[model samples]
Target: MSYQTTETIQRLWDDFLRESLAEVPPEQRQQFAQQFEDRFSELLQNAANGGGDGFLDLVGFGDKGPVEFENLPYPYVQPDFDDSVVPSQLHAAAELYYIYQHERMKIFKVVDVLLKLFRLGKMRIQRGPGARALYLVEKWKPLRYGVRDRMIAYRRAFNYGSSKAPAGAVTNVNFHRQLVGLIVAVAQYFRDLQVSEVIRGGPMINQRPFGSSATVQRLGIDLRYALDRSTYGNIFALTMEVGHYLNSILKLLDAPDIKKAFDANTKWNVIEVVSNRYLGGTAEPSQRAKMAESGRRILKFVADNNFETSIDPHLFQTELRPIGPHAEAWLAAYRTTPEGQRFPGVPTALRSTRNRKSIPV
Candidate 1:
């Protein structure tokens, strides 16, 4: 679907104004139309000028509101992994790096989908709890972890003999928890949209009033096509795996031997120490960049070719050739360890596989 640009937005505003003013009495219509047009034109102009907060706020969809985090229960069960692999610090680092990259890349895509929905007028947010929840999602940005920052963390946590690791590479012990909270917030926003009656079952474009009868009739289509079942399923799968990987990583970091190896006092310290040790080298810079790029491509691939549909291997290989070498390298290193020899294959987080199961919205 074509995104709404400035020109299209102005056209949409003009159409909406013309339709709305048609109901006014002929004697007073000219004055009313003039006033309405002036106000709406200003709003459209602000939105076009990257001052969307003003326009969105006027339409009751602004980001300047209080948002309450939903204490929603996460229902996905953690996948089982062998305890024998817990002592493999390299394996733990691999999982940590993989999941962190996944989290970083996924947020941009989520924002993209959200922005598209809002721009197309597929999702309407009036002033309420729902608006606040959506505001939280819109304002959310991933933590600023650059290549050097991540590499330092990895080295500190994994390489015990690195003293020259960069300063300012701190770790958030609650990183996983925070990410899970964002997931909950997103789910809450979707629920709010449904409850507000902004989304309904019908033809993509229909005459039925959405949300409130008093609201303007938007020219946009239903949001279902943009955020379909496949999209939700993929999100579910990704989040569930993330949670699983995070739990495993947390356990590894918290292990007594791991803490003693690095003289770490807290989970954050363990991360800082291990990361500094393992990733404090010149070669890591290029590797880290490749991993990040590969991560983005993988996410895009999954989003485009969802689990419900069969993916073409040739196309997948062509698009994700860079990932194959990295995945193989990690696998090869992992196989050198005793746990890898016993339980062979790509780790859960690194697999280019998809599941057909759907999670409850």
Candidate 2:
């Protein structure tokens, strides 16, 4: 996808990548080397699927030349929805984003905040206005945690230790809290030094008596290095890539030697729970009817024997195996649900054959 950042900012991003990679040091890279390769492969897949020529040129395996930032087909800009007036499942999503940008939480802390929102079942990322920016919590998985660390080794080198936190460790609660404090301190330090102004925005519209959207943030010593779009987007994509690589990561961690990425006290067992919050979908107060309808179409498509490649049980067992435990259950239940056949979008004729709902996530 074409980046929305300025050409100048994009050039700076390339330079930052070079510097960050240099700073990782050989010893550290050795630890996550296998993961880095797997993660890179995943990123390559996403870039191919979602990015345009610019991304292909800048990030491809061995393209070493002047950086090209313009002339790439841009990601279509969608207007920010008047989230204040709309019914949304994203109240928690907005809250988390507000907290990260204003509260300056580290990437992991932001993920935890998202988990809380997931339990509450709030909005998915609001495609504010014209899809100006998507803010889904889909990026808060263990893979995302790994991606964040790998990103440190390659993009935000200086930002680490001084800007964010130390490099070469797994994401955990303690580290998240520490990183949040560190980022805030860095912002304060720069503000006190008169290098830059702290940034701020929002009053969560659905504010309970105590909840509010008012928040602030500041990049540090250099205005260029602030945790703004450039830093956030790169890391965000890496997070998605990581989430997608969950299968590979879990496989790697299965070996006793690779499990060290988890800190000594870590307790998050990777459970396969179907969370609406995580998928940017919620069962309560969300457009579940819409999702259900969407889900049905998918079920039909998968069930269709005419497809170029039939989406069989084998496909589910293979491709979506990570989230399978839940996806399979949902599909079965929905196919049998009283309202399953009544969903809006399903074609009537095919409805009978697909009356049974079994979708693999």
**Candidate number of the best TM-score:** 1
lDDT, candidate 1, 259-347, per-residue tens: 45457786445555434544341223223345544433432332332222122322323443443344444333433333334443446
Per-candidate TM vs. native? 0.20, 0.17
Q: What is the C-alpha RMSD of each candidate to the true structure, in Å?
A: 26.5, 28.0
TM-score of 1: 0.20
lDDT score of residue 353 within candidate 1: 26
lDDT of 2 by residue, 185-297 (tens): 33233333232122222333111112111111111112212222223324445434543453233232242321232222211221111123243422221223333333333
Model 1 stretches with alpha carbons more than 4 Å out:
1-235, 281-361
**Which stretches in model 2 have alpha-carbon errors above 4 Å?**
1-158, 161-226, 232-237, 251-361
